[model samples]
Target: MESLRAPPTAAGGLFPPLPCALEALPLLGVDFSSAPSRQKPVVLAWGRRAGAVVKLEAIERFNALPTLAERLSAPGPWLGGFDLPFGLPRSLLQAWGWPLDWAEAMSRYARTSRPELQAAFAAFCAARPVGQKFAHRVCDGPAGASPSMKWVNPPVAWMMHAGVPLLRTAGVTLVGHAAGDPARLALEAYPGLLARAVLGRRSYKSDEKAKQTPERLIARKDLVDALEQGRQPWGLRLRLSHAQREDLVEDARGDTLDAVLCLLQAAWGAGQPRGGWPGDADALEGWILGAGTVPAP
Candidate 1:
């Protein structure tokens, strides 16, 4: 996970500067997709607190977004940190003459196809000077994330498009977007935020099997060690069995690790009041859970 400092671990499991609080809600971290498949399924890391430590219960994967949505909509309570942009950059939406309100913007966007979205974004960039093509949202700078509208490289723009609407379909309240259900709350999360905090620009995983190496494997092990020892500046300890540790290390795609990062973030949020959300959050521009300040230019 990517992250920044300026916060410390507190009793009750709050991660300061982010308003995170601790609790034992059914915690989850999701790595999502618009077109989910077995090859690259939607991954979820599920866990709950066991006395002083968090015990990861399971790692679940689904190849279809609709199926996952059905499961998320099931009754009772759960909270999750999803790795996708909850809102678009306000400036980018305005330039495209799209709706500025979060609901409207998302509704309009969900109707569009990936190909069309990419073409439009490319055309806009083509007309602009180099390096000034993309407009950013409030969280991008502080979160150190790519512009939400970029369609290539990481293709986060498409991710936002495919992912956020699922919360609505599942009737899971998006904390910043709608009146959230305490029973089923969904918040934005980026595993990179926390991973960066721990590793500091150290490369960890690769999709191409050929790129997976012993060095990267060692890096992953080191990361797990830091997490297990309660070394987070934020101060939450990850308690895993020897088998669990091996499972996390064995998965080279980093999907399980990313979900675990999101899991920790959710664990922190569960500990906070109102999920450690700041009062200044806007309905139009969703804020990241751990970010202290708004994203900059």
Candidate 2:
């Protein structure tokens, strides 16, 4: 049976309309990779702000993390949501006697080998109780994200180890990292949060080509429609030709859609206080763009 959940229109009334169209900004959403491949390259969903709508500009690809850094560091102004952890769990760092300062901790973390990092994380989990095997960042709960220390089943930790270093060297300011340039705010983005809000748990895209069935396609179209209509979850509308929409929805990998979602989230956060993140966000646990109060169960 196909995995699916609530459709996009299931809760369209839950959220208020987003703010009026944001000032034009170069928006980006990245689906990163620790070890990029030609077959499955890192994808950037690029967008540009038009008068009252954000337009899908392109689906950019990167086969290496270093090259991505170079592009980001080039002389330009851009704001983006990266689908990677910006910081490790404070609890884990404290428990392991690592530096409490976000910058210092990441400085050390960027130097560790994947094998060593995996073994250390494994040992940490081994010493904990079953229910508490993984240490979590404060942002994890509200963002509906997995523990950043995880090494398998998505391996976001490795994504962090590989990606954050590039951002640090990119000459661009990270919204949750430190203040440098307002025009180059790089924030951690979780497309899953927005997806869940709109579709409740619908399975829209699959990485495996064989699993890209008609149901997933319909789900994608529904999601795009909701975004176009400026519905809840976010009030940002996206504009693209029917061909672009078809291209975005046809990719079984969903990388393009993930990027697009991140781009919209970036636009939504642009006019908020500190780009929709709180003042305390500075490295230890950066927040996702649209994560506010979680709904009560």
Candidate 3:
């Protein structure tokens, strides 16, 4: 493994380099929306990591799924941290007699309709005990992420349905879940996992304008400061240009910032063995990129 420090460029600028074999690959963080539109488009943060510093290079928005698909398919040697579930719980799959194979499961999931998925999940919950309705992946507890089968609230289940197939179609390797193009690796990421470490349950963003308060703005600033100084467990600092910093802090929805957070997680995983996936990670359930040392469920 190489040191985390970035090398200097001829122009006196720093060129970020990822560790080891992935040194040349660009890093991407995607804040995905199942139902993307002009108002709430899918956000992508592009960057690179060298040593401890991860530089923010650009932020992009895709108003349509096709644009996202084109971007994923056109890429090579890029690792992405996507804010979406890559797989469902093993328990849920077995209970429903759904295919246990990752690829087959994803195929079936993609073929199913949204209403069918919702009804099925609803029934699954109805049959279970009130407090223990949803079957959870092992990483969910440690990452504090919603269930992959959950349909409402965060609608992460829908996100998985919408986004995972694109990765599959793009032939990107879903690390620890399915094999595809090794040069294009995709890891599940949860920005909340990192955000909570700094904010401690602070509400840092809200899509609704009425709920975007001053306190949340301060929380975003604090989170940004923490990342810039390499305060997280990943030991990777975030380097944003002045305008980039303002854009992230000013965006009340936090989509751009969340993508960058995911980017850092991906960069950290790129340096680890098996992209930081634990040996015990469930192939059918997948795992979050940086939810380290989580106990088995």
Candidate 4:
């Protein structure tokens, strides 16, 4: 037997090597869908980072969650920044009297049907005062992400219901939560958080073809240009072929660009200690990968 125990940590006692050092490994930025389809599939941007330059190598589209799940299950020393919530709001979980442990909470959540979840969340909101309907995870304030429990608009609650279970099944180690394959690390990402920093309320994408105006197109171009030059916050420049740049900008839906933004965020996290997640990330309410300072609850 080749010693059934796991491999030893890095020289600094890090369980897994920091991402910045693993420049040769693939970094994935996933723009996930709670309900993937032929029209709006799950989009993944794959690349490798060399110092501050992240080279875009490929763009993958999966028409179904199973396909995405299959990709995640494959062997990896790969790190992913998935645009999905890894956990629910701690306040919501406690109020509903749900399990607080990550595993148990997710297990119970997996079993709950979508309608039941919607009804539960609706009831929770109905009881709260106006302007304070939904409970928020600590990171939501800083990340500018929607409440994970929101059932409409972005339907992130459904995204959590549809996506998080697949990640759990894939056995990737969700940062600050369940530990799995040390080589495969997953972090919650909000591309809009990064985009807003660069674009400043400018709209870069729209799902409705009719709403995809020329201004949005220009915003996309400007955003891409900023990334290539290495904008603030992360300071990592994006290296894309002219064709890749055109492809990202031309895809009016913005899925490709969102995925790439996530990849950059993941790369930034990889360079940090413990994937940039804080030590006190909630037990059942995970934090976004690069969202700075948790606000006071």
Candidate 5:
């Protein structure tokens, strides 16, 4: 392993060589979402090595099923920390009389498409009183997400439906599922888990020009400070250049922040003692919240 204290070199104004230490980390954190289309939707995913706070990487965004299948089949010992929900809301499952296990719920949901899911959920809501129609899972309440089953406001259920099966087909091991390969781990992680711990509602990145004032720069500086001092819950450190800092601060849409979140997940994976890569079920699940059920394959 390389020294973590070394500073990185700024290159060509826009690129920086990440500290060599990041190479040793193996964790892969993914932020996934689907864009609507007249045909099939597009899936976008990105993340970084677990223990290293630099060197972000993106999984190729796919508009076609064959392209996605190719990426999923590529070789690597990856512990993917996807942003999708692993479990459906207990309330929604109960109301629909669906299975409660994460895998089963996703499997059941996978049988339906986007329009089908929306229509089914809408029908369920139509029979209930206006405000009480949508159902939420335990995490949804705390995460402040719309109903876990909702097609909008994050549409996490569709995320799982569309995403999980790919992992399954690719033969990756899901952390909590018995059917998953023990070597290729997949876990659920929320970027907010680390962001809130460090910034505490302080806006660190944005897209709006008006909000990109000096005050936000100071917040970015504060976030940089926290990351440098290892104040984040994951005990990770970030290395950034002055130009990089300015760019991250000026961008308002939070793309830079999302990238940093991916950086932390990479850092966390790199920190693992099982030679950086998660080597077994215990190590993989160690990073996951055991409260949620692991659905059967």
Candidate 6:
């Protein structure tokens, strides 16, 4: 077995610089979501090793757009397993008449304001029957997302609208999209899919400080053990130490857990073709802009 202390190196040199060495370690899982305040939204990149899923790194919060730009700009061959919605529901798109392609739809969506988009979506939904109004994107079904365009669902649509462009601009290759550069790859990942599979309905993390209790710690430990042993149906595993486990458990919001989940998604993507996603054909779509479905008002 390889020693955990050994640094991860790539074909050219050590990966991700020494400071971000852990991130370079292969089989990194990530969980990303926007932590938005009244001022600006922060993109939180959470990571964990594939084998030792329990151990998590600190939340790498990027507050400014420039910082995110710099990180995305950094030399890569590094795959990012982002938690944002990669596709919109098919139903929503047809109703709204947005561009069907991923890149084109995003460009059109970006031009509109939040309120305008919300109003437009609302009007569309209001006319439809209550239960069937909100449409899910292809990714949302397996990933189980709240309607892709829902504002309360942490503005994931906005995240896709705002963030995907940056990845494209950064020259990263979206795994299922047209490859602008062979070196950098972006893949759609959902940590919840993995988490639910292993520990259904059991809460693994909490943002509220009060939820970080002894019981949750034990649950996290169990979750970590399962991943390390590749006990899940997904064949995922984690590698970590006692101290690392304690550290990850201490932060209950599951930041570390989420990061590891993202890492796993990235690893899954690495095995697929440049223009394809890792899962079944029905679950994935080619890199089309505005890929998610729009909800009716």
**Among these predicted structures, which one has the highest TM-score?**
4
Candidate 4 overall Cα lDDT vs. reference? 0.84
For model 3, name the residue pairs that clash.
Answer: 4-51, 5-51
- Candidate 1 vs 6: which has more TM-score: 1
Sorted by TM-score, highest first, which candidate order results? Answer: 4, 3, 2, 1, 6, 5
lDDT by residue for model 6 (1-297), tens: 221112322211111111123335433343444443423334344344443343344445565656676777777545567766655665677788876666666667777887898898788778889797776655565455566677664577777766667777787666554455555556666666666667777777766678767777777777777766877655656555677666556657776666666666554444333222322332223221111211211
Q: Is candidate 3 or candidate 4 better by lDDT?
A: 4
Give the lDDT of residue 246 in candidate 4. 100
Which structure is stronger by lDDT: 2 or 5?
Answer: 2
Cα deviation of 269, candidate 1, in Å = 1.6
Which ten residues in a row are the worst by lDDT in model 2?
Answer: 10-19
Per-residue lDDT of candidate 3, residues 1-297 (tens digit): 642223332212111223235556699999999989998999999888787789889999999998899988984778889999988998999999998787798899999999999999999999998799999998899888899999988999999998999888888777666667766778899999888877787899999999999999999999999999988776689998999999999999999889988998888877865566665566667878878542222
Error of 4 at 147 (Å): 0.7
lDDT of 1 at 215: 81
Backbone clashes counted, model 6: 41
Per-residue CA lDDT of model 2 for 106-183, tens digit only, reads 889999888999999999999999999999877787778888899998899999998888888776676655544444
RMSD of 6: 8.8
Lowest lDDT 10-residue stretch of candidate 1: 10-19
- Tens digit of lDDT per residue, candidate 4, span 1-297? 111122333211123454334577789999999888988989999999888999999999999999889999998878889998988998999999998787899899999998899899999999999999999998898888899999888888888898889998998877667777877888889899878888888999999999999999999999999999997467889999999999999999999999999999888877776676655555468878788732212
The TM-score obtained by model 6 is: 0.74
How much is the lDDT of residue 29 in candidate 5? 54
> Least accurate stretch of 10 residues (summed lDDT) in model 5?
8-17
Alpha-carbon error at 27 in model 3, in Å?
0.6
Q: lDDT: which is higher, 4 or 5?
A: 4
Taking all chains together, each candidate's TM-score versus the true structure is: 0.87, 0.87, 0.91, 0.92, 0.64, 0.74
lDDT of 5 by residue, 1-297 (tens): 422112222210011112234454344555555443323233333444433344444423355555654665666545456666665655567777877565666677778777887887888889889778876555444333344566775676677777777777877755444244443456555555566566676766544667767776777777767766677655666665666566545545554555456546545643443222222322111223222221111
lDDT of each: 0.74, 0.74, 0.83, 0.84, 0.53, 0.55
